[model samples]
Target chain A: MIPKLNIVPFVSVDNMMKLVLSIGVERFLTELAEVVEEDFRRWESFDKTPRLAAHSPEGVIELMPTSDGTAYGFKYVNGHPKNSRTGRQTVAAFGVLADVGNGYPVLLTEMTILTALRTAATSAVAAKHLAPRGARTMAIIGNGAQAEFQALAFKSLLGIDKLRLYDIDASASQKCRRNLAGFGLDVTICGSVEEAVQGAEIVTTVTADKQYATILTDNLVGSGIHINAVGGDCPGKTELHADILRRADIFVEYPPQTRIEGEIQQLAPDHPVTELWQVITGQIPGRRDPRQITLFDSVGFATEDFSALRYVHSKVTGTAFFEELDMVADPDEPRDLFGMLLRAAA
Target chain B: MIPKLNIVPFVSVDNMMKLVLSIGVERFLTELAEVVEEDFRRWESFDKTPRLAAHSPEGVIELMPTSDGTAYGFKYVNGHPKNSRTGRQTVAAFGVLADVGNGYPVLLTEMTILTALRTAATSAVAAKHLAPRGARTMAIIGNGAQAEFQALAFKSLLGIDKLRLYDIDASASQKCRRNLAGFGLDVTICGSVEEAVQGAEIVTTVTADKQYATILTDNLVGSGIHINAVGGDCPGKTELHADILRRADIFVEYPPQTRIEGEIQQLAPDHPVTELWQVITGQIPGRRDPRQITLFDSVGFATEDFSALRYVHSKVTGTAFFEELDMVADPDEPRDLFGMLLRAAA
Candidate 1:
């Protein structure tokens, strides 16, 4: 008989999708945002470090690990911008949550979908704290895999019901428009970044490109808008012009990491930036005035992934959304690992 | 239908044991040693780094990652010495091997068994280079979970047919003696570490303790013996006395890592040590003199794990020792990841 300790609850892509749909994407985003906010409120309790990255010509792979004294979590993610040409995701990920007391993994799940959910939820949380008051319109400047999720998250979390979408590839915007159809939001497919950001209170730049291509130019971004900079997450991959970063009060998740991978990578190492946790914990003010531009230089952090895993672990109980994976070796006698192997032959 | 890209080959604990048994433990160790030696020979071609460790009051969890430009691999391992009291293995591990070209994981396997195999094989490989001419007897000071594999590896790889086993817990030594009863070797269960090391050419210290407990004192370690120090693998955890280390010419895998986590951790940071790869690659001499003591301070390296994964990947090609897991999400249109989740609801 297989030992219960050896069985890790594995959430596959299908099961994750089912779980999201069952809870409804809006509700999932709201709940995930709350979890992320709770973790942010207690940020000093986590063991934080810059992610370990292995870069290649095509892309990079990274392992992000963090523990909150009780549970340890890590996400294995790869980003290959060129993967889309071969019908593969530009980003794919999986993560594990383990018990810190015994150093045993309790949950193993596909994080590609969860990452999407958490990224959007994190954007919504930031917008709630920093966006201009009574903001109702968001300009999604890159209508790709993350566009609709960001749209729904903003709509659900902050009551933003209008979206202005634009992508260099027109079909991507059409796809986003089609996906968000009848979701109780007005989605306009724009042709240019200028048109997308026109009269918008929130501008999200989430384009998929390996190079430092400016999806939003300095002149295009106006005052008082909360800029969610998502695509500038790796070295040499910024989506906004440097001038825009210079003009905005940057709020980031983990300054050490954001300074390397976020839009602030273009700035000096000692450039002043506020940690988002400080804003969430009320240690610092988010927006000083309605005319002040607040940029959440969002380069997804490990704590958000930890919170996502925590949320999934809580929701997956008494549900069939996960399968048991026999990943660990369990012997009746701890020292009899060899004997267990020998006995299995019989 | 599930996409081909989504299916990652998974080798469970049971399958790993079966594969090891089918190949015969002796042959497996020999082959694994060869793979490790080959990787060591070409060490300059691979990326290397110190393992990232998260330490707690109980134990530690670490992530060891390395890449050979073409393929990337990492192992997730934990060492909790107190876990044995709860009928759990002191160490547990799992690993993933991914393609660098596309950043897709090709294999995910239970590394608890493979780690045991590779560690023993690595010891044998080191012994092959550093041990005295025609060394026939090995004194194993800790007859625990790793003892049998270490004994068999030495016996098979270096033609060491005699064994002397000792442990503070006599049942463990008795268990080792009983396990290797019919394996074509003379096994003696000794009462003390001094008795075990009597007349033996090689001494292996592999006890599982979280603290700096000396299992081998300097008085017992005579000249001309090759010591394989395996248990002192983390900070503040060592098996050999500082005097023993001072008396021996230490060789290590990745000096930066060994200086922090190996037996040499007791020595100064600038203490001279030889890289094992140099010896394997014929860049440096091994077993310099008959009277000189050589110690292989093995803290386990990522490249060795890479070689183990490579070896398993080669052998499991046409075998049913693995199951395909739906770990990666493959969308019909890669940019439509949110659409994939939305369509799943319908």
Candidate 2:
């Protein structure tokens, strides 16, 4: 059969999982982090825009779009905190990467898993610059769907060999601990948030709630550690206390968006925060001193998704991990679409 | 086998063509026009935003999103006028219809053919309200991909029996005339735009040039004629001369968007164009007099695409016209996405 120009390669959820397993999740995260870091180093080349969000009483559906002059990428993601009650994911996503020249979609992939991987990889990349050197222990508060990925990414990228996990629901922490069993990491489930953060060089807060519930207070946080605040991504949803934000040297992706959705929403509008690209490019200082508390205010950005999709597009080039989708209508005669339909009828 | 919540029904180009052909093109246009009319009546209830566009030297990629409180829909479309040189459609599209409650995508489908159908359907619907009563003849200048659809939609919805077609490339008009031969309409291939508009009650200028080209001048537009301007949809791209727009009582889908993209962009910033919805809802008059020159500035809106997607979604229920795509990652335990990947390995 001849290849159709309308066909777009699609990586379904099953195929995405198979691809991840084949590549080894840790290796995938490590390679993806390298791409994310490389993108950050030249972040000035990207066309950045804050996500367009449509908020409802139950959740928010967003379109995060960006382009790096050659490829345009966007992810359709939604966050509905109550979805889990119906056995649905609180956050689900999919994305497309298109050619900027021809404006045809090149890849369509399930981004729910990709989002988790990119988020963890992004956090690891930031921690590599901001976290204390030789950090081997990471206390992950809010052990939910994103917990194990975070643990593994830290292990793969930062070589963190120990994990301290904590969640309000103990079962969540237990599930995370079970998933990390054969990953060569020493995992411990802690009963309290304070117990999880005790004596850890890195503390990652990734709780998923829609309200301003403080999962980490300033009192619980110590100096000389990096904080990966992941869960506080939307307006009115934050995990760290205002006091914690005031104490740490916060860094963020896309300051305009981070100011609205990240933990910095609690701080003054003029509160100074460094852009992550600056640190990655060595334009600004990162982890100024051993005792400095560096916080990565992670609300997720479009470029990160763009990089992840671009990386996946490269990986699935000649692999059986994707199926061609007849997503665009390509008539034999470009201007004879009606004739094409008529021919189909015949 | 259990049904997965991650599965989203996708209508491929083949499936879409089959679905449209199965329903019959004329019937599809008539039914879709009704949905477009119905959506226009409730236009105020929709969450509307101007489309997000990324303009490049080659073309533009845009995301048009809207929601009617219950369901959300968005169309990803591109306009590349030069693409036809490479044997590609100048405009191609695909769209998604998602559930607003849980924010999971319910349907994904190709919109290239659907867009042509809806654009023609919408034009016919507008003409239904604005055109002269008993108008049977339409002169379509620029008979390209959209010409036959426009001709057939007018025939289906307005009972038009005569069509005069003209294109810069006479072969395009010949192709349109050939394709529309058996549709029980009187088709004429005119040598020039002036010849095409002679004795025609409705004139549609659907040229595809990206620059400002006056396909319809003021002298050619006579009284009691409705002008459906379809092709000059982007900024710096318009068909009618400014004098023609000055004489015609203009109507547009959305004023904010029309001011930038439609034919009225040549007019003053505060041009007194009536919103098409108001006329549909009977708040304002569409055609006030028999001798009035009415112009429908047909820059397609997101709501039209939304209505089209919603209609297709309803038609695809229990039908073989769609395939289920595992586009969202749903782990057995919502919090154990990592475990899902691990199990996939097993």
Candidate 3:
């Protein structure tokens, strides 16, 4: 007899870490960046919607869902800034990828680690399209949990060999510098944001505060720098001053979403910003001159989660990194659901 | 040392079935109805929104989410009419209940069985308030998977001792009749809808078709009858004649949702309807007079699922029916997510 189709592949946190290590972090970032870019190039074929978020006093819980013609995916993620004070991670996530034909989940994976990897990879993909040629150094303004991933992703994708890190808490920069040791990059712990971005070609801001605070003022930023802004992802959360946005040629993942959640939320709703997909698809130009500043204001869309899930599903197939979860109910007879439950008792 | 708070309790299909049987199916339905009613009584406290649906040519996939101050819950469900031809269920579901304080999932369970139970319980709860006093006989117009559960819910909740069943396919009626045997209720398989509704105080039409096919007409439904319409729950899909809807005193779960997906989708958008929760809370009268026609047009809602998850969470706290799933990633240092990945490799 054939086995029932009730089993769904599940990737636990340990399994996800193993998968990442087995594939090698740099190689994984490069490959994931390719997948994300590929999805972005064909962005018109997707069913897009802004994430559905439920906000509370502490944080927000969101459901990000999207579908291509054949597959559907969604992620359940939460951002609680106060969680770190209580020994918990500020962000936690999990996602599901399902077949559109059968409406059954094919893969369920923990996405906290994957989200970090994908966010960094997404930033790298945008930088590859918009950053200046032969850029050798990057300044990360907020050296928090995402800082290391951003540093490594830029190294793997763009060959950046130097890093400058700064944070409001100097211990965070020290921890980031210690984590990046032996990663084949010269790391500098700067006392202030202005010192961090002094000579760097790329500037990444990834702070974790839930409030609207300026981590980078306009006068501190120089010309010809590509800004990969990743931290300002919810309402009232931003990192850059409005002057920087006014002077830069801004690009975003999805304009409607970015207007609400990205750093661009500080600007007017009708602010003219190019879509990053347009730049990737050659529908719009990314960088016109070396002196022009380009900002990739990413708010993390559903399609990226979909792409990451598809990539993970491809790698984990027929591998030990995933286990079969009996999540879907498959009865012997289609209409005999009650009978199936009765038989289980006997 | 305190155990990490990363473990989420998961209830599998087998465990859910075992839970239902252990509690006794009738008692389970009765108690679940009570829980649902209790939530309905406090409907003002819930965060309400229409279900987020992604429609496809074949079917629809939906995410239904709601929160009640302290806890949040969401259900992922799909409905496909063509699935039955391939020996798959027409509907499959699963859900998660999480903490509002920390935004961490507490319980993950298969909701296909639970949806069946809750759907039935919701119908019975409506019937208890809307059906004529001492309603003894019920006519179930669709004898499918849900028919038996609806029969039992009515039996346990309202003491409905006699059931008149009818279906387009005689085999479905036979299946329902066979499954409902020895449940201490008189079940009769009728040849037609009119025959089934003969001398019945309550009429339930639950045929599953993806079109606007009317199973009940104006003249066929008489005075002083309570109609529980469950199958008309999607756009372009309804089971009642517009004439009958015009004549009945319509009660609905959520007007915003029911107006688009319930039997009243045939009526005007601004057509006045009574919310079921108002009746449950005693803020509005139910069954205003003996000769009045009352219709409980339930399309299901997120709060009912929230109540069900809350009910399941309450029952399975110390029981072996649930297993711990290492679904969340907890790093020793929340900022060292990469370090957590690195240590897992060794």
Compute DockQ for each candidate against the true complex: 0.83, 0.88, 0.73
Per-candidate total of colliding backbone pairs: 0, 0, 0
DockQ for the candidate 3 complex? 0.73
**In terms of DockQ, which candidate is strongest?**
2
Candidate 1 on A1-346: residue-level lDDT in tens? 1258778888999999999999999999999999999999999999999999999999999999999988999999999999988888889999999888788888989999999999999999999999998899999988888999999999999999899998989999999999999899998988888999999999999988988887888899888999998889999999888898889999999998998898888999998999999999999999989889999999999999999999999999879899888888998888888888888877
lDDT of 1 by residue, B1-346 (tens): 1249888888999999989988998999999999999999999999999999999998888999999999999999999999989877789999999988788899999998889999999999999999998999999988888999999999999999999999999999988888887789999889899999999999999999889998999999899999999999999999999999999998999999999999989999999999999999889998999999999999999999999999998888789999888888888999999899878878
Ranking by lDDT: 2, 1, 3
Query: Could you give candidate 3's per-residue lDDT for residues A1-346 as a string of tens digits?
Result: 1146677788999899999999999999999999999999999999999998989999989999999979999999999999988777888999999878778888889999999999999999999999999999999988878999999999999999999999999988888888788789999998888899999999999999999989999998899999999999999999999999999999999988999999989888999999999999999989999999999998899999999999999999878998777777788877778877788878
Candidate 2 residue-wise lDDT, A273-318, digit = tens: 9999999999999998999999999999999999999999998887
TM-score of chain A of each: 0.98, 0.99, 0.98
Pull out the clashing pairs in model 3: none
TM-score of each: 0.99, 0.99, 0.98
Q: What range of 10 consecutive residues in model 2 chain A has the weakest lDDT sum?
A: A1-10
